[model samples]
Target: MRHRFGRRVCITVISVGALLSSPAVPAVAEGAVPASAANGSGPGYSDDATLRGKIISRLQHMTVQEKVGQLFVVEVYGQDASTVSPTMAARNRALYGVDTPAQVIDKYKPGGVIYFDSRRGPDNVQDPRQIATLSNGLQTAALSQRQPIPLLISTDQEGGAVVFRLVAPATAMPGNMALGAGRSVTDAHRSAEVIGTELAAVGINQNYAPVADVNVNPANPVIGVRSVGEDPELVSNMVAAQVNGYHDGGVATVAKHFPGHGDTATDSHFGLPEVTHTREQLEAIDLPPFRAAIAQGVDTIMTAHVVLRSVDPSGAPATMSQPILTGLLREEMGYDGLIVTDALDMQGATSTYPPNVAPVEAFKAGADQLVLAPQMDVAYTAVLDAVGSGEISMRRLDESVYRILRLKMTRGLFKDPFVNVELAAKVVGASDHLRDEQLITDHTTTLVKNDSDVLPLTRDPQRVLVTGWGVTTTTTLGNAIGRRGQTVTVLETGTTPSQTRINQVVADAAHSDLVVVSTMNAASVNPITGLPTASAAAQQALVKALLATGKPVVVSGMRNPYDISYFTEAPTYLATYGYTAASMESLTRVLFGEVNPVGKLPVTIPHANGSGALYPFGHGLRYDG
Candidate 1:
């Protein structure tokens, strides 16, 4: 079961270069310290004067290499601390001159480590217990160094499309757009708190979450569903709520992609995205959520790789724009928190600069922590060289290192960096957490269209065909319907199903009494062209083929709700916003009248003809309404 706040606070007392076996101190909390903690005064973690004094003393003794290492938070290719697949071992050896995560920490001594689990490639997480074990091992290695400092362990557990690293066995949320649809700050906080509690129990201390971007562009590929909604006010409210939730859940919060990544059509992963909003428009729309985040005292703010033409005019992404990061955020907004770069390895930030130069440039641009440098060893050395040549002043470098160490101390990492590995298995994916997640999911299953009152499955169609994009998710939904006493036939139409497969599904649907078709961003916009992909075309074709069969068709949108604008003729439509099992189950309940659909549209669904909104924001249909 999920423990209540202040119920499981276990503090570990730590001093530099030594593990004191003294009794535990009553730390502030698992994931956070007070806002004053940043200035060297917070209870539980450390006494204020002592905290600052100790960090200074430690800094005095550290070598230049060690100080430079503190600026980076790199990714290692390994599942376990000491063991890795042969291919992964080779990659690790090539990158860090080591074959395991623990060894990498010992050799290069990065201030932090970020976890990835097949979302981008390579798996550092397997299950809750394994993750806790790995975190403990990494901490042990970091502490074993000459100048011991506990590593900041972080992952992108944003709870929807971005939760791939820690999805299963960790409560899966319906994501930010879903929360926006619900429009309930209480639900948003509860959801993030549950996610945060589960992560902290498993030894993950930092979360890159509560995406503060107010997604204004419908064609935005990266931040579409991940964004809370297009409305800046609503997104701001949700962002603050989620920030508090994560902190209360025992993890530090990062409000991300500042000054904003919402108004672009480009995906920074593959190319540079430019946001051209004027400073006035930006303040009105894109910047409010981040402002709210700062008001909520968010632990960190991440820089986007997108360029804001009005802000810098240097044609540089915000990751390397000192004007945006230091001037706008630090000086203008009065945000004194850590500023981290979006992964430097991404094409968006490093396309112009080589691997070695990007990290140094990001530091020069006022980022406190450089995340995911492509080549850690080379980047580390480059930063060291730049500092040696006074290219990056020692004062600037020390400012970042102090923030890094301060964050570690405030988050209770120095006090107790290890987690109870055995308890992690029990705490994560616990029934209580799942129940809270289900409650949030229940609020996010939006009924966008129910023409002719076709929903509630009141006719009790005995034969139902459940077919969609993901095989596992499709089968899961079919099983849910089957549990409701329907004879359901499950078919997996690939994301871009072949014509033969579409034909096969159409034939199968003809024999069924009701056809439920789920689309996974069927009309997904291409990042570069701002047009739907061929896969989207194929998925649309499959839906059209099914509709022609004359069965009672229920089109379910499992990812983006915008797909509904394309198939305007569908009699019934629902937007789950995700394909997580919890969402599918909630969707099944809404279909069979077990629950009522209360979610509104977070973003406007543009008409296929490009005239106007087919379904405006805040539009939803309840069975009774």
Candidate 2:
């Protein structure tokens, strides 16, 4: 069960460095003390002032090598004595005696930590409260040695498939595409508040979210379900709502993939992508959401690994292009927030330049934070050298540090680095969590097609056969059926389909009174093109199989709603913008007369082969009373 905001809030740091024997540390203003000491003077510290002072104090006390350490954000997970001990051992041996959480915190402190599921342990999952307690304990341990400076506890909580579930009391909200369906800024605001409140309860101060990429291209491999909508204005409004939601709840929000990744057909996580739109087209469509987010006082912006040839003719991706990051984002957009680089270890970044060199170039290009490095020492050293050689200005470093510290201050990190674990346990997963989960589930399930009144499935349909490559026992859809009926049967089709196998699955469905077909475009890897077109084989076989079922066939989209055209013959169709357990339950309720389908298409579903662009952006069927 999910926790309420107040309950979750009850639950839920680092380091120093080498000094002396380095070339000229930047001179600090005389009598300037650490921000903690300067508190209670004047208007108190705004996020900017507090952050500036902290960065300056660190710069004054840090050696060149230590300064480099501050630039590399390495990946670390888990607290199993055996696993962490060995990982720390390797860091100590390779990165100059830095080992243990204490040493990592005290010596080579990185700007932030990137968390994933593999890092969590079984003990942390006993209950919502226990999860909160364990998470708080883990964070507390990470920063035990340092004074309260805002340490960014970050995660990719974009809803749907990208949620981190191990932590206590943190409930996953609906994906952006679902929010976009309602086209209601109110829904967006509510979502942000819910997500932000849960994050605050668990001690997470930063969320890498509100994916600003416009989903203009239906075939976009990576951003289909993640984006809010294709229309720039709609995306902008929704982004602002999400940012405000996080801020109101006391967690910083990051607007991502600047300059847009909406029209591209490839996934940046696997390889480099190029967007060939002219500057005007990009400014008109791709940049509005970012601008809106900035206006709403978003704390951070994450750069995409997309290469926009028209925007930056320098032949470098936006993550490493000064013309895009410095000139366009900073100067033109008037954004003063911390600019973070997307994971540098991803092929999009690593494929272009050596890992060590990329961090320095990214900094030079005006990135405030370098995320996900393969070798922390190498990347850190490269940045330090670049700064020392005067290739990157100290002022630029100060600018980045100022924004980061400001965010920390705004989050009240300096005042209270730890939450009362026992209290957090009491409130972390309560009624509010469940309520928000239901709201998102209700608001995101869309009714794309309902012919012959097949929906609100008659009580106890004689035989129900669920056939799709995407449906499985673990999915919420499967769970919903498993709880009430024994007659339902589920079929799993891997990533792609086999004509022979699909035939057998469909043949079984023909005997059933109701047949539901599902498909998903989970991950695509085309470096040269960013499109995520449906597989021809899968599309053909699924459509053929569903048509052959003869029963009332309901084609359900468990991913983005775009691929529904593949099963054109189905009399009834529905789109659950995401595949979360809650969404699946909500979808089943609509199908089985449990709840009304209130969701509308947030984005257009283009025809196969890009023929007919049916249901253009913001098209959804409203069920009138």
Candidate 3:
């Protein structure tokens, strides 16, 4: 109940006690919780006197402007500042409203800079070398300032579902849901460790990863495949494994979307998601995994933008709610780890307030760092003005900067913040990493539904018709599928296919001895659902068309596991979690009886025609070898 004084705090209290008799907590009902609920005695809360002394020492050398700068961690191109022309900087200023990544550091004096996939320098040049050089320059700029603090260059390197943003050049691992399906804590650790090496190799010290959200809602358009599974305990255990792996690989970890991003049907990226679950329900379900994450000693906790009505009756986003951030996470949960807000650029956090004031509000709400505020200049000005006018206390500002600097010190940034540009190029995307990535995909390639016992697919490669959406027609999986002296008519379906177009492909299925189709159907609400909805529909239509031909269709949901709900009549079905080349190779090996699939379904595969699951969470089939 510390920091619980405002009307906001009262509303949160109401939410916590709103339904005491509610069935939200069976464990609480069964007397599973400890007597102490709101005490700040947890492992993540740093009462380390020495660390506090170091933070105090660091604070003594900083000015008010410097202290304010330390509270912001905004976006930047992870490239050298020298390479950027003044004209390009102006263009970026005009386009993105920032002078330059380095200039922003010089002016705003931010604590960190998050990297993204953008054209570095004036030209559209992209490479790992640019990333390393840019990081070195950003750190150098930080150190050369009045207060020589190293910049914490961070990225969203959550290795799951897809090879996205910064980690594209590195080895592609099977994502979180796939890792859960494989059901190996060892694999989860190894996968994160491998990703960490790649991240560190490129000079990224902090990784916003190991999504702790349990995918309890399949219609949850954003967190669906990104989450490990729907089960809380299972997600908790996997989150711990990932934290260990990140540490093992020497990367600072941030276990994110705290409290939980699961169970919400809307995507926070597009707009605010209204979470109506009672506090009891959240404690029993969503809160446990985060509690587990804290026990694992996570470095940072990122807040979700979603509004939990139970926590705030006025429906404030968690990032801007003192009740959620300080009351729940900091006091009740006993987590003193750095509280970083999710990008203030998202609609979920911005819909209620003018986007420009996010930085000030986020800090007031208890967040240590303002992350990725798109309106950086306006937000930075807001913070400066607030601190100057006494709207925000100077002491409070120092506390956040202390945490930020302490994290930098913990990352060994003060001593050796720079990476060897050459070493970065050599170590990043290492050849050996591919072997590890392949192993992950091999284990994660789940055979979700094989009702016809047609897996360990017959090796007769005589004119096999291979059709898929999302993946290229001919890749490692396609090549391997036809390796047994057979020709494959690779038919690639467009993401937006006309029904007539799907009909044509179905008509062409007559010439082939066997038909195999792969569809990517995992759903996430990016503030709006129907991500590739048309493609899912087309794939379903293609399958139904093939079914009409009596061609004994073999189907694989290369991305989403829920695809089995759409193509229920398939004699054979598979869910590979990801559509990567590595996953495709694993599917090929499984098809030829070279590898036995031990993968389980991470989330429940809902029945296509209804609300129930065709195969529940943790369901997977085996071949009688």
Candidate 4:
């Protein structure tokens, strides 16, 4: 295994222009020959030669079209093929020859592929083993067509509400906020190792995680619970530890939403968000974690579509800004690993730049990969034209390609690109999964308030009313409560519930002895501003109703702890750190007095009037009585 600093030096020297401008390609002296003459036996073509050589030689032979295709990452929801329209399929086939996994692999040959939770097996049969089998099968089919360069398989397994390991046998880890509560870098490292080990078992080499953004803005819509915490230095340490953990487990990590999305009030998924901060301020607060990750040799950095006017005065977002990507991240911060643009389909990038031009601009701006292009042909062609026309040098393309190949080589992708289905099945659902889940559950339960000795809900409560938005029949919290109490009523609210639902919740609270209200913000935000709009005034309204009942209202925040201000009057409040099943289960255990809440609040919760009276970064109330 490569030491973190050693890997960083190797990637940086070769990737950051020192070797790009060298008179001779590094492999030429090592006996690299043309592909046709060598019969794949050239110095650069053999497996004996560092895997990097084979990748470089293959890339050297690739036409502009093929090279551009290498930079494009297509989004395939699942093996079903129905999620993508036939028309779109036909278009992909026509443009990049994307049809069967082999055709797509042999034709467009993307550097990576990203999967969502929807790609897992069918509803009833979904399990980590099933996911591993399906993923390995798909990857194998792609490799069988042509000489395979290891395809980077990635997923958003950030744990908590954003878990893909939903089925039985696969364990869920707590979110970053929960890890933050432990206030131990070792805890963060353990969490990363657990997630990395599971993902690696299933052939997922890349995890889009260790959200580097500092959760400074209380109202940040999407990044609340996902962030590690508000302090830049602490987040930096945690991010570094997480990266080290992943690397230790042979899983690549991508520190995301770069240039800092923490202080912004809007979410970038919907539109572009403007970060109104001086360059110095951003450097001090927002960019510290990312800088730390880069310093720790993180494998990749994903750009955010956030506009930082101070950094790039042209109003260009970081995803499309040369100043931010090439100048700041690469030149200033010394990050030479793969630079990936966030999904092109996102409104933040798509709305600003023309569809065909965005990918090209992204490459020119220093991104090595373009994710989820709407039209591969137009995007690929634009990049090819840029390279051929010298708008972006072939050296630049080579630089990016080399770094990507190095990563593949590091992963031993060239030696064995295929996965053993049976072995994967056994490892995917191994005992380690369950153990890690339990550890995270135990670590995330935070006891915010236990005033008046109203905990452990004595034996069984006669009437328990639980109400919250984002809760449903399948919700783990509700199920846990149902198991413990005889009469448990759960009220579900929509994203933004109507007044009628609020009134109904108020009426339901009247007869309940113990009322638990949960609030969640999906963290989806306005793409341009990065601020979140609280959906459903229900949290604010439910507090008033629960206060009227004169009973202990236990308020739990499923998302970010910032929402606690809406229910400050509640005698007992807890922050589960996230909404994952593990979190919910742990929270239930705490509520019923089955477990003590040892975790502290990672982020502060302000007063309802936004007076900044929120619980400070490391505040947790423990019951001594």
Candidate 5:
């Protein structure tokens, strides 16, 4: 769901902070799946007379305005242990409502609300007590409404890079691509269950996760590492396992960027990206994983902002395209679950429709929720106006609300909407959960290329110079090297280093016994390679100069694995795939010969051009080999 382009779009890495520790699921038995798993006419729920009766009854008492309100799942700020703080007051007003969060909750009566990690810091419970209180307060306000309904609290707790939303000491599970490298469906299942369980504990029930996008295009700026892998079948199988894990663990799972966001050069956040795939192409490449997610009984399918040229000829992004969201997804695919649009604040959506009209357009196009409608008041008013004018029929408005209510009901929100603060504090970042996450890290770190067998360092070289051009925090990677008792000089060649910095690194390496270059492009987009600028020069120069030292350098692409082709001169190359502490732990263990590297590349590391990958999807090298 992240589209910030160059900004580090990940909330992974770091530690448990001042929190306790904790805590994935089992398999699918035929009718054993939850009856409320799918909203409408889903497998075992069709004959649930009580569920149907409740929905019909609720519809009769609801007003058009109330029904319209249910279609929105807006974003709100501030965490409340008991009362809102003075410091949070300013942001609360700017983001949530005219006054307090409760006022916004009572006025909008949005069916759900999502929380994102503050652009502020690490993903930890700024205060677990505060969030638990906030959840209870929001639910309290929902019940206070005339037409009372429980709020479906949601967030992007998708693990890996996007773990930003949950600030509790929750375990940062490896991203989807990392789990894919583990090459086990069980790992995928466990990862999701762990994530879902923790999210549920925090009172955020719906996870906008298990990205179903197929990373077919190597140059794809957005979906590259977020997706499971480039191959459709592997991505489908792995994601489907994760879906079951989420459901079994008690949180609703969302299969995102529906119809797929892969294969595009432009990021939808910056501008709309067009998917020129014909029906056959889409069905074969981009659509299968979503097809798998639907079959797996996911609670919601989030629409992509990208336009499917073959499906919607109007060039409208799929979030507002009836042809894609309604026609292709609902009618053709036979998916009865809810459809939620990606955040409307992104330019992909803003570029196509007026801010106030996007929700109405998406609703008419058949989306159940208008996610992160930043102009919440405008979006809400427009939808309400459309309903009154019959531009959006009462029947349509009722359908979405019915689905939203059904979702709340299915999740048992009506019965117990509030979360226990004490339980959440312990459950959010419980120690055992962190261990399981470490187990996942055990299997997901891949070594893409270890040329001339320079890995597994065999010899404990005394002096090691570890540096890289794009490194962010060198402490973890540096500390790992230092743990070997080697005097490690960690040189961070920030974003793009200067020639002087590279020369200094080389100068330092001359007297060193070994040179271990740690690269960190671990974020979403590599501004240097992702953009054409002077920075690219610094990046290339740094690596070239290091190689000129004629030292046996171990180049680890701490972020993008493709740094291999760029640093082909190095005798050894590895793809940590992330710069998180867990990733660094995996890399360090392999370097010190503690743990054998066994991860496979989840996505193909393509060459400079978008033609082919330097390392194919399944490529990897193990230390044991």
Candidate 6:
């Protein structure tokens, strides 16, 4: 039946006991999903208690295997239900005993699927219509099941350094650190809304974003540009704003890598890391943003794989620690929301517990959703066995299943699991979103050092050279500068530029009136030595050579502001924090004095010796003042 949007239709609830004893029944018959799900105007969906009863009724009727399946969100290999290529077909057949996404969904009946733009595998994203069509196809496969439940489609759409899987034609904002640099709560909310809106338009209902980890450690390899800032209070405010923003944009928000993935040198994707901070230190440094997130009623909080030595002396990562997940996050913090593990596929998760064992451990430790299960066959079976063996109590399983159902209901996934494939293109990457993104990016172009007023290039330099580590990044910046009627030359040197490339840039700089050198983590430290790497040495050589040209030089740190300390001899420095096309364009405008740069340092720029701050946090020079 076609339910009109906003109509107050009361859904009658059946007896829970009867539902438990009876054979499972589908929530909605095939080809009969209501329009409320797609339109976000479901009747009585806003009434939490009413939705709770409906979810409980559906939960009681689910089979044991279905309940277990509800806990997993697997990574499928194609943009659509059919396998895209022979390689993907073989991989899917081997992994799930099926060569197509539809067949895999039919067999495993997983609760959700995650999309990724990866180098090693087929990308699950193409354009907006294709993604929306894929989502609809998956939902159609899901609804065809005997006991249907919609999938919670998720992706890491965290704007900055980590590109959202949705790709271009989707609005790409200036990441979390850029928001931190802007230091405006409104900008944070707006940027998140833009991201969430674009994601939702493409039928992705959940985002693993608003990285709540307070990046106190400058040496942090992964979370540096992804995190908002170093201060807990600032991060907290930003996190809360994003939670509200994502909701406003019609997608569930996830505050990730709890209790904190910050303050560590290790990247969880590669190796296991430990946070040895005491309980006092953790509460003061690593947890305020999470607390703020919980307060904002975030839909899910993703567990980190790192061990908190102070909280759980057993040395278990947060994903497998009952003391940390249940005692700390659930009981002490009073957060009753869903706890999801951060990709069981990561080495940090699998290092201690194998792929088959990690999901069971994570569930036992109180995670509701087990994400990115690499070994789906083994992981799914292990969880099922754990439930059947009574090692995982039925009540415990039901608790997680209930949260998963409740999320679907709250998000109106139950009423309408599909998106309008036609409207997706119109909503995603719209003109307004791009404009707002540019405005926010403009606010994030931080002018850190403008010694002797080398900036606001009052005299229009006839010739300009823009050389950077990223090829597209340099091209984008050169294009932007070229639009301003300057003769621009663009050169891209991969992170470690050779001596020949360095000499080429210096020679080119001699011909140009002004040289712009962009560095990508050129000053990143070696984890053990807490000093720069050999790769940093190569990029530094290029920068030092450009500075020696006797011509005016502008060094732009495109990833992190810390690279400025490596080339202090340059007359001027700017921190874009990220190299989104919007960032490059906005940066070009700031260079020509078309817009005044107001972005500040979210994280302090430390001395080359790593002793103290070279430029303290909140330090940004302005063209006007």
Tell me how candidate 5 scores on lDDT. 0.73
Question: Residue 207, candidate 4: how far off, in angstroms?
Answer: 1.2
TM-scores of the models, in the given order?
Answer: 0.91, 0.85, 0.88, 0.84, 0.89, 0.92
Q: What is the C-alpha RMSD of each candidate to the true structure, in Å?
A: 8.5, 8.4, 9.4, 8.5, 9.9, 7.9
lDDT of each: 0.83, 0.67, 0.73, 0.69, 0.73, 0.83
lDDT of 1 by residue, 112-190 (tens): 8999986665588889888999899999999998788999899998987544479678888769999999999999999
What's the C-alpha lDDT at position 161 in model 4? 65
Per-residue lDDT of model 2, residues 520-567, tens digit only:
652232335533434645655666666765667777777778656655
The TM-score between candidate 4 and the true structure equals 0.84
Which lDDT tens digits does candidate 5 get at residues 1-625?
Answer: 1121112122112121100010101111123222343333573245335576677667676655566677888766556522555656565567655456776676677788887666742122366676777778888888987778888888776667544466437677888778878888998898888888877776777888889998876557777668887889999999899999999778888999898998888888798988899999998998899988888887899999998879988888999999998899888887767889998888899886886789889889989898878666667667755654557655566667767777778778888987888898888767887888888887988877767676777645578887874354477777877877878888888867877888888899898877877664422344346643355456666777778888777777765566665555666777765666777778788877788878888777766544666778788887667
Of the pair 2 and 3, which is ahead by TM-score?
Answer: 3
Candidate 2 or 1, higher TM-score: 1
Arranged by TM-score with the best first, the candidates are 6, 1, 5, 3, 2, 4
Where in model 5 is the C-alpha error above 4 Å? 1-40, 43-48, 81-87, 95-97, 120-125, 459-461, 469-472, 521-536, 609-611
True-structure RMSD for candidate 5:
9.9
lDDT tens readout by residue for model 4, 360-385: 88888989999887666567656755
Collision pairs in model 1 = 12-415, 31-250, 31-251
RMSD (Cα, Å) of model 4: 8.5
lDDT of 6 by residue, 105-221 (tens): 887788888888755375778999999988888888988887778999998999875656766888888898999999999999998999898889889999998799999887788
